[model samples]
Target: MNENLFRPQFDALKLSDKLWLMQTLATRYHLTFKELYAFSRWGQSCTTGLFEKGGREFVFVPGNTVILGWEGFVQGMDKANQEELADIFAEIEYEGSVEGFLRQGMTPVRQVTIGPMFVGRKLEEIGWESVPMNDPRITAHPDWLDALRKLADRDGQSLKIHETVRFERNGDSWKAWLCHPMTYPEFQRSLLWDLAASLPTPDEWAYLCGGGCRTLFPWGDGMDYSMHLHHFESPEDEDKPFDMEEPNFFGVSIAYDPYMREVVKAEQFTTCGGDGGRGICGGLGIFLGFLPCSPHCKPKVQEDKELNGDYDFYRPIIRLENHD
Candidate 1:
């Protein structure tokens, strides 16, 4: 009867209850304890009711308690980087040092118990249902192909529905290719609603990416320009692998592209991961552009409020009550 959750996900439960649910699901699915724990502290990921459709995978972020602020990392920061960050903050009109500005609400380095969570995986190639050109959803607009192509991959990668689908513009047998990305917003909503998963909170997100570690990026604080648009800027580099979104320690692709703003579940900012390329895209150079890769980076600006409604990069998470 001790059915209480420590963090609303796993407040509490008697040993029997934990064993019961784990045994029930694992036994029926032939899942081992390690596999069962996958949705939690271990295991890359295991499917559950969360994903109703599509191929977007999910991973388990185990509950943990650690200092979730910049205080623990400031001393190790290089003096020049500190100065650089401070300058960036000053340019943004923040009154204090770069560290002080970042510590605004991320301070106190208190102990936080993030219960085990199942997070949405941002894969390199998510399965999208291509839309047929002749589908009734198609309007009579001749420019639809060009405009939609803008949204698809430019070089024709995973999001490249525009590049792959062949159409003669005014051809008679005009039928479209894969599912339109325009449908992704509505489709993603329904999936989230059905799975009972919501976007990960900043802390939850930070942990998922960096595991609450002091490193800026989940891998390290170093900046790899090859991971940015700079890698793909040249004509000859067109076929090169952008090499973005490598799986993190948890095997979940959260966010890395500075241009692609990722949405998060937070009262403020409501956005994390990248800074919309304001740093590098703004001509500030790679150092600033790569800052958003830091799990702790705060890119909230005046217009960030609109991200939740329009942004496409977001990782949804479901809280499990049996977070042992």
Candidate 2:
């Protein structure tokens, strides 16, 4: 999860290209390495997710922990001139499926990305029918669907006829893309095993899993919930820990891992109704030798300096406005 480890990976890249990639990512995510590590609420961990947006393919095989954030891990991974990195950019250049693209290689990459259109085509091929009502898992929240429905129902809208269909069509593709693996859960489970099997040793999986679990506190409540965005801003009053017998209604819990010098704690802030309940989940953990002077450590602040100028380059491309 250490970003510095990735420096060796990118040794062949021109400095400008490296900086450009860093800036593009920071702009897209609205994240700084410091801010990310100091404020990741999901606990300390590493996980990989793949995405194919519009016609673009990206294999974000992230190895981030609470300490190293996405920016750090990305820079680390890009440090290499490996085929994995080349494959990532090449498929993204052409419209392609992550799994399909990776299969072309002997050692397939860990993640997969089938974008909206591709996923839609698969759904049609499968003959799956739509649910009459929106389910919480399908939508980030009910209101997220409601907002889109309101747009479709606007007066004089060409979408008036079969408005639900319009709402369903536009959003379903993206949801399908996100949940595509869920449809083939067994297949994906096999993938996990394949990933474990391919690792240098099976024991490494246990080490990674143990390291990753320390990074996320499961909100195991059966109810569907969204990760509240307000967790990142200013801190508010800290309350006494909840009583053990009291029902845990809050969405997530704090996770601290001493080995990583990582601390994942939730800081209180307002929630849904502005009714003053606590749900501002913030995660900030420490990494040993984040500062200079420790063995095998260097100041990661250099990447920040390199990224400053190009940080907002992605704004016009796919940046979502006003997410907060």
Candidate 3:
């Protein structure tokens, strides 16, 4: 059997032909296909869609050729967006700090071909198999007062976002979450067992976030200052809630916040996004704060100095390459 029958060059197919092919894919693989891209000043948006397995959802990123890295903050992003970002620059310190870092040797540019993949929309939480619960699940628990009290009692007054899961109990059933910093092997083992998926590569992570678009953020180049980016200059600012990890056009949530460094694959032992909340809480200003979301940023993953920091998370992806 041709394993790659599910993968096709969508750009070459005509509109009607595309629809016909999409139908086969839908019926055969339980995948839904959609054309979400068009040619533009920077480039065409990557074709992204959706699929489901194990009662969980995933964003399907189609295969395509794309430029992987670039030189300057304003280089890959088009002119109009450059102008917009410059205005935001005026509100914060530039020359000595963020600008110097940006001006330095940026992520080296090179064209690369990426294959289709299904990316998880949310970070994976561990420890579901322990109790053998029939309906195991995990979700954000902001108002978990009992768990909060227990956490504070065990650790300290402040609510930490680390290994501890805030589990809620019910008769013969329970749910758990808040475990964002699981090691790669731990997540890999669970995910592969559950959905036959694993974490994404650095390049795949880039495509998931930027989708080959020459823009700063996933949606576009300009930043929406209205959304809190986890960067704070004062104690009062820290009080503000973190932005919800919303899905990008590809239906995956990634590279949005600098505080959460998502664990990546390979022998090097590195992460794809974030500085582990260092820049966000370090008074580094807004530019450094939001830099994690940009695909062009170099040294894509660096070692976080803090010990077993709560800033780590995992994003599992199912590669659509030939099983043969």
Candidate 4:
């Protein structure tokens, strides 16, 4: 049987399509508030104001956009509902604790509450000022936060946004959201492939062989660096852990790998082998030997004009292709 058949026909649809499909589904099946809430993982709204779904839960900050609140779960149905769906006008009631749900390992079947403080400081916390807004690193976090903040600040009151969630004593909720921020404009997401496609391939390759020599920087048009790597080195063992000294390798004690049969001597950088070839081959974990720069492509500006305002978190990098 075609799995898509039992599944909602519009399961693959975007958020916009899901909205219309949900309304149509509700009207067609005549689902009720309680049933819809059960299907959706929404515990309640406005009164006890619990929006519990799956194993997690939330408290709705009333007056926020209705679509943002409920639009995430319309397509994925866990099971078929036999109860007649209720109309919005019909009064329904439920009681659950959003706080309680989150305390457990269970997550709300879907995402709703935006992590407020973490999002507010995403750009400043990271080094956005060092890069351009159009830069991949620059746009990702701010764009995502903007979307979330816009959702929270719909009515534009801090208290109103906070009021949107009140987790019950044993309800599921968002686990620690210290995760990094996200950028948008590529529609769904900017996979690494997208970043690679934007970068123009280098016309030439320069090889490095000297023990303390760095290779020619390789980068082309479009965003050249999608990410960065950090290395730490120490030379002496201290009570704390280790310290950097004359023979200090980058981020580690200079260990001689017998298999490679090479003595990884201390280099100019705090890393082990500083020879040109060793520095250029930088992949994390094997060794924190060198820092390599790659292009990170930024997507075209979004169609939404409202998103064109200045972003405090990112500086936009514009690289003009040389016509010559």
For each candidate, give its TM-score against the true structure.
0.60, 0.18, 0.65, 0.14
Better of 3 and 4 by TM-score: 3
Question: In candidate 2, what are the lDDT values of residues 6-82, reduced to their tens digit?
Answer: 32333334545545544455456533311111112223332122234333322222222222111112112122323
The numbered model that scores best in TM-score is: 3
Off by over 4 Å in 1: 1-54, 72-108, 123-130, 143-192, 221-244, 267-269, 299-311, 322-324
- Give each model's whole-structure lDDT: 0.51, 0.23, 0.57, 0.20
Off by over 4 Å in 3: 1-23, 26-48, 73-100, 103-105, 126-162, 165-182, 218-222, 226-245, 299-309
Question: How would you encode candidate 3's per-residue C-alpha lDDT over 136-165 as one tens digit per residue?
Answer: 332233445555556545653344334554
Candidate 1 positional error at 5, Å: 13
What is the TM-score of candidate 2? 0.18
lDDT of 4 by residue, 1-324 (tens): 222111233234454543443344334333221211111111221121122222222221111111111112222212211021121113233233322321232112222211100000001111112232244542455644464446454543321112111111112211112223233323112322331111111100000011011111111111111222223323331223321111111111121120111111111101111222343243222121221121000112233322111221111111122221
**Which is superior by TM-score, 1 or 4?**
1
lDDT of 1 by residue, 166-263 (tens): 33233323344443343334534654675566767777777776666665544444454445354236776676645445555566765657666666
Q: How high is the lDDT of residue 199 in model 1? A: 67
**lDDT minimum window of 10 residues, candidate 4:** 114-123
Per-candidate total of colliding backbone pairs: 16, 12, 0, 50
After TM-score superposition, what is the CA distance of residue 118 in candidate 1 from its true location, in Å? Answer: 1.6
Ranking by lDDT: 3, 1, 2, 4
Q: Model 4: runs farther than 4 Å from truth? A: 1-183, 186-214, 217-229, 235-291, 294-315, 318-324
Off by over 4 Å in 2: 1-14, 17-54, 57-213, 217-324
Q: Report the lDDT of model 2 for residue 301.
A: 16
